[model samples]
Target: MVSFGIWGLIPPVLTITLAFITKDVMVSLFLGILSGTLIVAGGNPIIAILNLTDMLAGSLNDGWNIRIFLFCALLGGLVGMLSKTGSARAFGRWAADKLNSPKTSLLMAWFCGLVIFIDDYFNSLAVGTVMRPITDKNNVPRAQLAYILDSTAAPVCILVPISSWVITVMSIVKGSEGFSSLGISEFEFFMRSVPFNIYAILTLIMVLTLILTGRNFGPMAKSIKYAKETGKLYNEDYGPAPGEIEVEGEQNSSKARPMDMLFPILVLIASAVILFPMTTYLGAIDGESITSLGAAMGSMSLGDAFNNTDASMALFYAVIFTLLITYIYYTVRKLFTIKSASDAIGDGIKSMVPALIILTMAWTIGSVIKSSPEDGGLGLAAYLSEVVVGGGFPIALIPVIAFALSALISFSTGTSWGTFAIMIPIVMPIVVGLAQAKGLMDGAMLNSVLISISAVLGGSVFGDHASPISDTTILSSTGAGCPHLEHVATQMPYAITCAVCAFIGFLIGGIFLNLFVAWLAALGAFVLALVFLPRIYKA
Candidate 1:
């Protein structure tokens, strides 16, 4: 059953199709889960119920993965509250007033996307929502806005160190004996791999190039022209209609201030960066490494004097602090009434219900996949590695193949995290085996590991950016209110352009430089964008 690719995908495909047809993702995901449960349990009615229970329980117990969904839900609530408070509108007004040029606005969108790399979902949602109105006001199309958000999410995370995705992948890698014996720490190896992550580097370059060149073509070109001519992107009315802004904008309103918006966002980021590293540095942590929550927990424990009671509960503490601080600031600043805060939280949780359901189904399928090695499911990595090793394939092609595999699975599954979870574990072993066979030292083996991981991440993000059913795609479309298919159609070409060029760059980097250099060299795609963009738009 695990050997059947279609078997693994059937339930998810049916669910996604249903969602698209009904325009209800929640229903689609639920039905998908149900279908999987029924199929796996073989129609034993009681056992089917039991399987569903176990799936739900297992997902809840999955710790970080589940916690992330919860965190996203809370953030969603914050967004909702902020929306109702008109904080987003105020920021839009400010952005519109400050950044009057389309090029600058586009650059700002790209920059914000790059900087907000802590979590992909947050990147997709927050950045998309905040930037959409501003972009539309500046005559940027919704398809363009979706492209910006979709491009930044996985690509930036693949490059960053402290991201949740990195931590998760690192944990999985450390579980492998081959990885452990390599004597290369995960962070060190991850950094080395950064330059080899061709997809990320190239995407970043593409973003900058797009901003500088202002070239639009295909669906994007059409969308941009339509936006400029009709003055409607995603059918949205940007700001108050002309003279209406003079009337409505002048009312003495008690909406949330810009400070109210910036404070919580800053706190979330600071807590993750400062607290995460400090705790790890202080040595109160134990694991593969100290996570962001662990660091926050360590601070609370050591700072509390004698008891050190809060040490084990760092994540809980950090989450509470974030939620409370965000609520208090929003409430006191009149961003929302107290009742609104509570309602926002509830609404936020509700918004995340679909994600939670999907997460569980994904985990269930992942659990089945993880059990695959036991049943001779060496996975695609094993098969590809075997072919590459036997055929004496050039090292230059490793990143390309790995990236393509990641992209393929991610696009099919509509989830980057799932792609990472599936591919990294399998790819690490292949890298180690190949290194040993080639008489490479620990250092060379580590290089392979880094390169492989980079490829996986790059591919995963590339797929997510283009996949019609991807969560980020949905979120991007929802944020911009662009038709999902339209966004997907418009974005795929640009993403592919980066992918092909990045693949070439990766091959060159692998042949000449080490993995990191190869990945870094892919950043040259920005230059490619500069050279070709004018022609694209001109056409």
Candidate 2:
């Protein structure tokens, strides 16, 4: 294997630059993988091809990676089943009558996005499918519905404690070097970082502000104006709306109720919440050799309990349990025949094929970067740590730098999870090293690490929100029946507005090292930008 040192940056840089130029994520990522393999192979074309194949196989073979892929597919199937049963249609009709105003329609969509926070993919499609008709009836622009869908999807999932996002992030943190020595459990660290996740918090707040105030700016303002006055949801240049994306239920069934849709979703959420704690408690008892359940529970903190828990396993079981219950309920009520329900499940999994491909490629490339010398991969994280330690960059500014870099990368790649997989292993070690060098460990150092970690997550979501090629972005457009480009164009200003405020917030947090003060400054910036920026668009 060759040692490229700083030259290791070429692969990702090439990936990002090419993605922006071509606007094709799959091609961009494949080329990036090939380039990395070439470098590792010392410019041998044949060897590079062999190395790339091995990398892909290895990524797919990992237990955690395979489980996550399955989780996404199964969740998609559950959503499809809900749509097939007429649950979504009933709920939409029920919601439309209750939400008679445009503002209420937007709020309801936003609320549904919040409610289905288990996974972002599910959030985008489910919210869009359920709320599009309602929003359309109220003359809410498709662009606006897309915005609400995109905003609530990843942003809400990243903030919520019980989500797959939290589980993945915790696992990454636990596996990081020097993490165990810090004397903090992964869950505790994750909880601490929540307050520092400024970008997500600010974005959600901005969504509510815009919804309540009924203010629009930039391209979105134009779209809303056109929709309101001319009843045209799309720009004149874009094609006709795709047949409204909807799920049709059995025409013969008169028994379909809104509860048919809601019950399964509520069960899914409850199972996740309940199973997480139960699994954690059980694991603690078994692993720690505690004599009694009460003593085991009392022996550890909440974070400790979570650290001992098998989150992926618990989530997998929860989803499976929910699906089984849903299928049984539908069959028992005669809403769907067994064969029909089976077909719906198959169709649902099929719907996620494109997303699955993207995710697999993303994971494969991440493996390419993280692989060791013996595996013929560049250890980017170690190289970065060496540079930061030896280089003259200020430690305090790390959070700001991290936030900007993550945003740029995610925007270019159109995948926040991929960005996280690449950034966390690299960023966390550097933060911990810097803190140690300064003789800081618990309070100040831990806070710095948390701020930087949260910045990476928040910036990624912000960038994904702005990227036209992002999976969630595309899904949101599909869900809302809006032309994809129209959604991207209209949502850009709102995302940028929040991102700018988040950037400034990270700077304040880095310099002041105070989460509360930084949050206040960021909130102030958001209000000022929201109030003033629209005037320029008006002109």
Candidate 3:
């Protein structure tokens, strides 16, 4: 059964454990995919091989992922160039000389991760790569750096209005005939619903607090302790050290010009802003409603509507433009040689090998699940939700449980979009039905506005942020070059802390406040988490 694939947790977990235990992530992941293929194909090795081949092909053929990988590759190239060109080092040196404090550098790193809300995958890759060395230079562990990037990735997107996610979610909601039968404008309802999104708000607060206060917990806390004790984190036992980047050359003595750092970064942000929404509009349909801001064009090309060709093209064009501009800038300024550019691209592609393999495996497993029995998926998900929220538990507690369940499902399945695509449609209708039954429609009574809002937010984002198969999660681990489970393990404690506070806030909102007051209280709770928790982290 598709939903029964919650057991799907076993594959990735085992694979990650194999990597951790044997100290070889690539082999472990490949073997894990083989194991999953066996399970899904009923142990017939012949069918398993056939399915595996198809699954791998589908992953490679998917235009969306190609765009993502290309973005990552380009980001890698950009980071490589920046480092070789002496840009990143110059900026780091300047920051060290001026900003000076670990707290300020960490805070700046956190802020950069938080504000890049165009797309979570892009945010995770770009921020993690750019900030890792900077954070490392300040003695921050890669684990801590990974956590900051992971924390900001999905949470920030949920809170923003014009993100890639917003465009997609709006399209889904607007198109769902089931939702339109309720006579509410989707965008307006979504906006109204945003404030009570406790997970997003709280996660953001937790990240900021962690950055400012430097606390680490769970595997993260352990990783930080290990790094402090042994002077390494992530691949410390095997990977290159900070000072080992270059040896026995004048290059080691050369410092980068500051403009080298600022220019590529500025180009990246500007290009993303100009290009992301442009693609969405380019993908819009003639009769479909479009809500995001970037495109002034009212109609999309035919190629945009039914084909991956258009969407992928838009992403490629955007990335190519950014890369070209970056290349031209370096050329004009005499900061890069053509040989160096070639080397940067080569290094970037080399770095992507592991990520490409992991992604291929993840997609295979997803395809495997989708091919399972239909009743299995919807039934199991519904059952899971009911078990968590359907008990005699107080209505106020439902949202907390919902968040937990969604987080678990997402973390296990490794696909937030899939989790959200399945969960929100189901949960939203239930929440609305409950609100109407309780006479809480439009603040008509003090029934469960807080409860309803929290359910949707927690359900949607829990999966988005934590799912091992999640694009954001995969991207974060790949970007940070930390082991995948290492990323999940380190992030769990922080995510749980925010979830707990959100639950408490939900209780207060449901029991004691009006809808408006309830949302304000939740927002206040988010700020409170930022303040109190920062003091507790030992990072």
Candidate 4:
């Protein structure tokens, strides 16, 4: 067994640098994995290449990983079916008829983002599609619409425990050595961390304040004034907004109903909710016969069942069943033939390929970083924790540090999930070590851990919101028919404002180790910005 020591940091640093430079995460991650395998392969390039392929294969070798992959692909297929069947456009038309004001149109977009919390990909694209027409009619700037979509997409997904983001994050956390040290289930830890996710909470608050109060700051203010006064949705200086490239030719566009979209999503959510407890109950039974659903459920509390649930499996099963029913539902409505439905589903799977590749790379790198030295890998978590603890690193400041660093990485890399993949594995062990060194109470240590974890989650969102190359950012712009750069520029002010508020919150929370006070302070700071920043900026 060989210790990599500081050398272990090379792969992540190289990955982050390359991602920032290339603005291409796939290539960046591949290179990063290749580098790590090189370290493990005794600096042999040929063997490193071999190890890289093996690592990628091994990432998908796990039951949990494959189920998550299938869930994501199936969910994508469901989204595709909705698009192919003109369900999204139908919902857009449905909302268009009732929304006469810009604020209301924007509010509807936010509402859609909230409801479509199953996946951020679906949220940004679907909400944008659903609200674009109404917002344009009401003279809302395309940039503003894009901002709202971007805000709601990832932030909302990260906050909700049932979403793909939660499953993915939990999957990553479940594998880390530090998670084992926490003495709680991954789901329970995630649930406890929610209120401490200050940036996401503040971002949503900022969006609502901007919409409800019709206040604006920085580039957004100018964008709003220009678009509303000129009846232009986007800047003419930037040329026509890019094509949305609708998935299918809305053949029955007029005949399509909003329920075509709504019912399937509802079924998916309902199925997952019900299955979570049942599956946990059944898993606990483990070969015992359960004759009655009521008796079995009554045996265990609902919250405990959720805590024990295999979230990835539950979501995968739920989406699988939802896809089957959705196919039959759409076909019966004459939205598409069996063959066309097949094609749409295939395309949807293809759409998820980029994300899947990122996930695969993320998982592979994470495994290498945490694998024991005897396993031909660097024990990064153990090594880094030792270094931080012994080096007199500020024990309480990790939450703030994690938040800022996660933001920088995510902003540079243009992917929050990727940042989570990179940072959480590293941050968790260091925070745990620091907490131990301080001789803190178990409850105090837990609060610190949750705050630190939430910092990583929230900070990644800040970077994602501001990054020009982010998938959600690009999708939000496309959905709203806004120029991508214009959207990024206009969204920067809001992202930064919320980030500052989140930073302050984490600062206080980190110093005092209090989730309650931190969140209240964070919210109050955002509220102040919402109240005074607009007046000051405009004046």
Candidate 5:
């Protein structure tokens, strides 16, 4: 990879700065991409303009990107159908009677978030779509809902050993030549690293504590207080929220029931979980013996199926089918006319237009950062890797170094998977080289390797969990009907809190090589935050 020296840092930095300052992500992303292209084009203005359009177009050309775009839009359409039919309102009433309080409502949303942990995209969209009305009835702010959805999505998925995140992570580690020499299976290594993933574990704890204790702090607290005083779920001061454009028909029907809102969503969740694994399983299965679904199921364990699953493709298929089911389900129940249902679906797709545009620009900039150096791309990940690893840090500080660099790279590129691709290769060599050079083949060495690898994974998630340009971050706000910037702003304090604790944990782990002790120390700081933050920064 070609190096751009310090110049590679310009695009994401410019984009992030502009976003906070201007409160306009589209303009920020466009200018960010344009800056990178200009640098890549070596000051040729005309060439940079041409390159810009090409890269933007090129982002959608990738199959996974297009699939995810479609899935989000279709999911929006499904949510629209629920809203149009009065099912959402009915469900809200039902929930308000049962849940009764803000704590219960938020906890239910958090629980729903944890349940749909197959993919972060699915988790955020599905949980937000289903739980927003419930939370709204309890007067819980949309910003709070978005924060829960965002906190749960990536953190839960990354921590789960069977999630889509696991597939990407395991593939990276399995491909490392040094890993094979360690004589442990990829799954075994992943399981060992799980305890060391302090950020994901601790963030979930923060969410739970916040929900239970009503510990609102920073911008999130202000949003909560504003909602309580004004009776407005959304604060208009920020600007128009995306995912609020869906057309609605006033439901005059008395037949609307909670199941009207729920059955279709249930099918969607069930179908995604069942369909994705089968799709992944059947696609990867080989030989005549695995000719049928039963045969395939018999062939591999459930974990194997998930490991092979393609979350984007499966979600797109699941949403298309779920849309069909919901359309028919709503019409037959007399909640909507055929024409009304069709219009709702169309309007739902319309609602997602802003999110799509932001996603497009985000992907384009990511491409500009990832593209070959010769092709006017910065090779930003490669550049960052070279610059960071070239410094000779001590072995005892490896976990801290791994975490900080991984977070930086992931935040810069807005992709944890991209960070893993860059960092894992660099990180693996360090641990493996140490093992071989010292000829140490003991549990201490194994614990060191596991903690270092876990640090990289945890650090990567820190960026994905909070970065403004991250796709999951964008989707969380869209899903919850909160303005995107509000989601980013409110989430920053909590994300930073967890990230700091995670860094401290890794520093302890690196020095002592004890995962349990390091985690406890991190937990101790987190406990202090829980006790003091609400008192210090009251809503």
Candidate 6:
């Protein structure tokens, strides 16, 4: 193993710093990969370039990565079909009647986000598209819409039980030596850890608090004021794309009904929920003859059943099924001709190309960090864990430290999945080592483990929400037709406010080992912050 010692941190740090400075995610990621590869190649430029290519190729070739990429493309196509059918517009009109005020409109967007808890990417794009027209009509700023879309995307997914986020987390935790040796199932751990995910829970709560209080602060407040006073939804620097306006106008011209949009989404959700459990049960009974479905389900806990299920495969099947159903529904309703529907599908996939590219690069950088030293990978997790352990860092402070590190990493990288991939493996081992050293498992030590895991997830979401380079952040801006930098600026204060509360929650939870008490304190802190901070913006 070619250990880089503490030097392994330089690449990611450089990548993050440059991203903020240049405001170019692609270049930031590329240069970060190059820096890491150069260090691995002993400063040889040619080998470093070759290594970067190999790293990206390996990431693309991985089965899980390929599945997620395909899912994104297919989901995009489905959304495209929704747009082509005028379903989005119909839904917006229907929603406008029910949600008359700006506050209610924002809440409806947040509620839609909560309802579509399957995937964050889907959540960001779909909610933004459907809610943008309504919010704009209600005089809500595009930046505010972007903020609502972003806050609900990953934060909601991470908190929910049956989402892509949970599946990925369970899969990673299952593979960790700590959980495996302890005979603790990843699903069980995930369920137990949800409550301790203070950042995510608090973020969600903060969204509602802002909406209910009819409060907008920081840059968001100024943007909303401009929209209200001038009737311009976007800032001077940014407006809706030509394509977006054209689509909106086309949707207005079409005769599609609200069910046109609502039915397809309902079908998609039902199919996923039904198929996921059924497939999980089937996988659990592989090579065994279970005479009845009920018997098979009874044999395993829901967690175990889901644990054994191929989540990627389940989502793939669900998307394919949903697409077929959507096509049939539209054809039956005479909403569009076959040619138009097909064109929409193709266009939708094209729109997702940028997101897919960014995801691929994010995965590549994560792979580069985690790859073995023999493969010229930095093995960053192992190195960081070593540094933390050896540097006299206290074990009791792991949750808070992990929160800060994960936030920084995710903010820099703009990908929470990448942060989770790099952090979980590193943090679990450290937790195990600390637990063993303390000769504790069931009490405070176990709580620490749970809190630390939650901290990583919570912090990653917080960072992703705040970062301009994040895919969800970009998509949110696109969805709301807001300038990217404006979305980033307006949302940062809100995100930071929640994150501060979460940090305190983690600190209290770690010190006192009382999840309930810590959560209450954190919630109170958030409420107090919300009440006081808006007054500053008001002045």
Reference-based lDDT, residue 52, model 2: 89
Give me candidate 6's TM-score against the actual structure. 0.81
Per-candidate count of clashing residue pairs (backbone under 3 Å):
4, 0, 10, 0, 0, 0
lDDT of candidate 5 over 396-486, digit per residue (tens): 7889998998887667656676566556655775676665555556687788788889999999899889998888999899889998888
Clashing pairs in 6: none
Better of 2 and 5 by TM-score: 2
lDDT at residue 151 of model 4 (Cα atoms): 92
Candidate with the greatest lDDT versus the true structure: 4
Model 1 superposed RMSD (Cα):
7.2
Clashing pairs in 1: 195-519, 195-520, 196-519, 297-314
Query: How much lDDT does each candidate structure score?
Result: 0.61, 0.79, 0.57, 0.84, 0.76, 0.76
Across residues 428-538, which tens digit of lDDT does each residue of candidate 3 receive? 434444544454546532235335544545655766676565667767776666777777777876777776666666666656534555557666766666566545654
Candidate 1 least-lDDT 10 residues: 240-249
lDDT for each residue of candidate 6 in 426-525, tens digit (9 for 90 to 100): 6876776676666676666668789988999999898788887888888788777788888887898989998999998888777777799779778888
Please give each candidate's TM-score. 0.72, 0.88, 0.56, 0.95, 0.66, 0.81
Model 3 regions lying over 4 Å from their true place: 1-43, 96-203, 206-255, 280-313, 372-399, 405-496, 503-521, 524-539
The residue pairs found clashing in candidate 5 are none
Question: What range of 10 consecutive residues in model 5 has the weakest lDDT sum?
Answer: 244-253
The residue ranges of model 1 lying beyond 4 angstroms of the native Cα positions read 1-85, 115-129, 157-177, 182-192, 225-254, 281-317, 357-396, 481-486, 510-513, 516-530, 533-538
lDDT of 2 by residue, 209-242 (tens): 9999977788888898888789887775765565
In angstroms, give how far residue 431 of model 6 lies from its true place.
3.4
